[model samples]
Target: MRKSDEAGTRPDVVRIWIALGLVIILIIAAAMMLVEADTQRDQQEQVASVISKLSTVRARLEGAINGNLLAITGLIVEISMNPEITQEEFSRYASVILAQKTEIRHVSAARNLVISHIYPLAGNKKALGLDYRQVKKQADAALRARDIGGIFVAGPINLGQGGRGFVARTPIYEFSESGVANQGRFWGLLSVVIDVDKLYGVAGLTSSNQTIEIAIRGQDSSGSDGAVFFGRPALFDSDRALLDVSLPHGSWQLAAA
Candidate 1:
């Protein structure tokens, strides 16, 4: 009888241990799952924060570009209205616009794709007669703009005026003749160079205080594919805010990370 009782007690003890072990295992598994869930939530929040910051950058970038573009529009209008528009005379009137929008580093008028007149020529005097046809880098964009017979944006290249920046060139056409055939005769170009470095300041995209990175690429007037003008061009490869920047006769790809 005593052996039987001892045997039963042993079995009971073993069962109790097994039950405790199972409870311990379950607790550990639950804790691990909770930890994983918390980690995932944190990661999601981080992603959200990054996206929000990128959105802000995108908006600011668009505003800066659009605002400056308005200045360019004014230049085109001024030149379009008067074919004989001289740089000096135009500068006297357009200087105020430049002062208002400091992002425009310089405005130049090209006669037959040659730099003829530039506003505030004190620093850019060297570009006075530089022909786009002679400038290898600028020549392609120049010819394209002329062939397109419209405004095109190119560069962030070493400008003839010195330093690196973007040039928005619009081929001027002469409608001097009365006939419809001569109404669209090609004239010259009115271009504005936006300083690449200074553009960050104006666009408020100078710092990377957010998770998402921002970049810009120059594309042909028809599409969003070209060399990077600013930031990591690879950002465009990943998920990003593809902002379109309208130029005179072209556009740019603004990638916000």
Candidate 2:
């Protein structure tokens, strides 16, 4: 009888040990699962934070681009309204624009699509006789009705001059037959060549411990080369590729990584 009772007690002891081992294993597994979940959540939050920062930076840059375009356009329109502006008058205005060294690159005027005035930088002897209308896209843009009152951003082209730059043109209109018309017919195009390097620097992008990239692309539906205006890569081996985006007219898309 005693032996039987001892045997029964031994079996109960073994069963208790097995049950305890299973409970410990379950606890460890639960802890590991909780830790993994927390880590994943943290990573997702970090990615979201980076995306938000990029969006804010892009918005600020777009505002700057628009503001600069408007400033140049306004200056051109003001000069055009003065019907009797002489070469001396233009030189004086050019000097003023050049004085704004940080922002203004160069101010120029074209009469009947011929280079008339190029500011600050001299030796424009060759530029004088060149017909701007030869650049088909620009000539077409100059004729657009919307170009009269305001300015339009033009060209990612090599301006056939010393530097590669873009143009901001505001059309000059002759006063209409009706006295009430504030603007005249399209007589000429006033443009400014923006220094690409200077424009990018103003965007306020900088590298960090992690890799970073910045780029600007235009929105075009026709699937033409969406112009990439600028980019800065943080890594030496980073691929500099244009990112596609849907952007509104008169607006540009900025992307960062």
Candidate 3:
């Protein structure tokens, strides 16, 4: 081969190599795009799963709380009907209630802001004669129940009996001679103590640690404005799915990541 012929062939070889390099680059870019798409899809599916679990948790939590809170209405009715009811009757009624509701720690009746009667009075003996006016932590909730003439749920606060729990209270009014409830005549407060750990267990929040991260705020049913009572506090500050848990008298915030 002559020199001119060899130089022309070298240029042709270089051109072929450049074209092959461009094809390889294109293939790599396409593969990278497919991998990115798969990653995004997986992330989306995980997010959807977490959100579904969050909804279920919220429903279970609200149902357990509201249903248990409603159970104490019978005791409230009994006291309203007979303000002079003795300890024997109170104990009997409360015993029946506690037997049915496993989440309830104890039930008590506060006559004029002072706890007078409690059922299964073994561990809860200290709660007897407890004056709400004297306890700064519990005074507001106790007073609110009376003033509202309706139900008020308080805590995840330290209980007088022991441990942490929620206190559900409603104002009780005596019946008039005509059998009508005397709204103007204040009798006292009827309260039910709900165990927090047990309630969380019933709500499936504790078992969800493996799949989703959850946190609850709005202690005392104060909604999003209140402090976190469950899970990590940082969850509320990050990008999370927020839900409102409706309570007897207020709402709480549930956050999930």
lDDT at position 165, candidate 3 = 95
Where model 2 places Cα greater than 4 Å from the true spot, the runs are: 1-40, 136-150, 159-163, 175-183, 206-211, 219-225, 232-248
TM-score per prediction, in order, is: 0.75, 0.66, 0.81
**lDDT tens digits, residue span 1-257, model 1:** 69989999999999999999999999999999999999999877866776676567656666776677677666665665676887677788668778987878888888877878888777877888989889787788888878876667777677655677767777766645454532565667777787867777656677645456677776444437667767786778865356666565656666664
Q: Give the lDDT of residue 36 in candidate 3.
A: 99
lDDT of 3 by residue, 1-257 (tens): 99999999999999999999999999999999999999999888877787788999999998998888778878888898888888899999998888888999988899998998998789888788999899889899999888777888898888655678998988889876776654546888888989999999999888856478899999888998998999899988855478889987888898888
- CA lDDT of each candidate? 0.72, 0.59, 0.87
Q: Highest TM-score: which candidate?
A: 3
Residue-by-residue lDDT tens digits, candidate 2, 75-128: 565555765566677777777665664555677777776767666546554666
Q: Which ten residues in a row have the lowest lDDT in candidate 1?
A: 174-183
Per-residue error for 181 in candidate 1, Å, reads 14
Which ranges in model 3 have alpha carbons more than 4 Å from their true place? 1-41, 176-184, 208-210
Could you give the candidate ranking by lDDT, starting with the highest? Answer: 3, 1, 2
> Highest lDDT among the candidates is held by which one?
3
